[model samples]
Target chain A: MLEIATPFVKKAGEAYLLVLQRSSEFETYTPAVNSARELLVKMDPQAVPYEKGQLGIEYHRVDWMGLSL
Target chain B: MKIILGILLVLGVSCSSTNQKVESTATTDETEIQAPAEPLKKRKTKKQKSAVVTPPQEESEPLAEEKREDPYLGVKEAIKNANWQGLEGEAQKILEQNNQNIIALNALGMAHFYQGRPLAAKYFLNKALSINPNSSDVKNNLAYVTKKEGRSRQAIILWRQVATAGGSSSKIAYENLINEFTIAKDYKKVVGAADSLGSQNVTSVATLNSLALAAIVKSEFDEAEKLLNQALEKENNNEALLINMAILQLDFKKNLDQGRRYLDRISFLGVQSNRRDIVTRLEAVAQSLTNQGEVK
Candidate 1:
């Protein structure tokens, strides 16, 4: 399996060059990758800049009114 | 068990590059070559291939040939003459007759685009797009407007769509792809786009330099050297080229004197210097490497 090297824009004003090491080539077609915002909370604007793998962490239900059953 | 941890990110700040989210995949890029980016812009197995690229400007000469029988002559002439104001009235008049007219909608969008009115440009172009979703012309124009409006990822989708479709304006779309992806530091896409173009000489100096940088990132040192040399032939004084060429040599442990000389040329640029934050940092890194006898 062939692995390709690619870089990504990390910050404003410059292309932050992230050189990921090669592992195994992905067999399936790459997904329609989401934008940074799209990958995170869609409705919640205040909760941005989340750490990697933060989405997997489950959280208790907390509404804007702050009442739990 | 797989442990792939060699991710060397030379992260630096840059204001010249835009805030664009780049997708890291060759989903739309179909290859005609045996290996991906083995050597950029050489073999061409098909004309169907298209890569992401850049936009156009006013006074477009090819767009000038007055369609004598065409009704939108006023708008066409206005664009040909860079007269955005002149086209606005004519475009609006055509829209008044039939709001869905593609020519009129495109004209209005082009006028707004050249006038630095992205919101208005997007409004008209989106209308035109809704009428003929397959129209590459409108999509390409919309991509430019979207990019300018700071919706770069949206622009990428449009550019990628228009580019892969391969129409009259596909060249422009491909150019935008190379430019945007390069700035976003999405090197694979840049290579993919450049490969699709399949031309050796027409590429600009800046583009060649970016291609070289991409090659360097891929650890294709020989290819990077060739690209950097080709760029230097076009514009030796170009600051980006100088810095990249310097990095290509210094970081890779090539000729010490030449790399140092390249960096020294940047100092000569002085007040009229390339003030890009990334570049300054790259220079500093190279300089420090040499100082510490890190580069042999």
Candidate 2:
């Protein structure tokens, strides 16, 4: 199967970069950790629930109004 | 618009079962498969709803005007006219007329989401869910708003639920979820989801590549290698798949020889025009491998 074009990834990466650039509290650590956790879950769904919850918390920690509420 | 109305009128009559039975029995069993062709022409029905307003529920006055019309057609016209400004009001009116109407609520929520009001969209979508908790449209709309609000986890959850539940939008929801997971860098989930979809279409080699990448990222080298071998069994000389497999070897496995072989496969594909930067990155990887060997 043909993988998505490189330009698509680049464009998405650029958007991600812009989000980082605009934030005063730009923390690459959080996004990276969150991304890593998400990747882990995708790789193996039956992993620890706490681990998934931890990642979910990290992903939403930066939200001004919170992710769900 | 007039043509669309004419088509709908023709469809309304042609859907008559008596005519269908007569035509079918007259044609014998050999032509039964082609009978649906007549209804296909009526697919482009006209929408009577206003440009900016959401459609009303069946009991509402707006529904009286547009109930005969196709919901998708109304949505298209609303979008085409750039009347997003009035869609919420229209949707609200429809809801007021038929409180239990799932379709009106879905349209309202979708309009609100398109108009860039996720919070409002969420409200209407939640209302839609209340009406029909299993509604695929509401779930999809809710997921969309959640994603826009940067709540990708919630979106992923909802999309997965919709995909599993099975609905008209199930495939679309699944595709979007894959994209969302990709953006979130939830590679593990992407791999798992791709695997689920892969079984549905075994001919698609990309699914194997996705699974391989996830395994590589998670440091499951054996699994990644196994999946790559499986993909190659189905396809030979697939440049992207080869490059992906090679990148995994070089980055995670530190197997320079294997990686080089994969890159060589990419070169044979002869599509260098778009892969210039990727090729450059691969060269750096090759150099690093070479340096490590020299140091050894």
> In model 2, which runs have C-alpha deviations exceeding 4 angstroms?
A1-69, B1-68, B79-83, B86-99, B199-280, B286-296
The local lDDT score (0 to 100) that residue B284 gets in candidate 1 is: 68
| DockQ, each predicted model | 0.01, 0.03
lDDT of each: 0.58, 0.60
Q: Report the error of model 2 at residue B96, Å.
A: 6.2
Cα lDDT of model 2 by residue, B209-240, tens digit: 55565566566788878877887888777666
Error of 2 at A18 (Å): 29
Candidate 2, position B98, lDDT? 77
Report the C-alpha lDDT of model 1 over A1-69, residue by residue, as the tens digit: 123322222131121111110100111111222233333324333332211110110111101011011
Candidate 1 residues lying further than 4 Å off, grouped into runs, are A1-69, B1-81, B87-101, B199-206, B225-237, B271-296
The TM-scores of all predictions, comma-separated, are 0.52, 0.43
Candidate 2, TM-score vs. the true structure? Answer: 0.43
The docking category that best describes candidate 1 is: incorrect
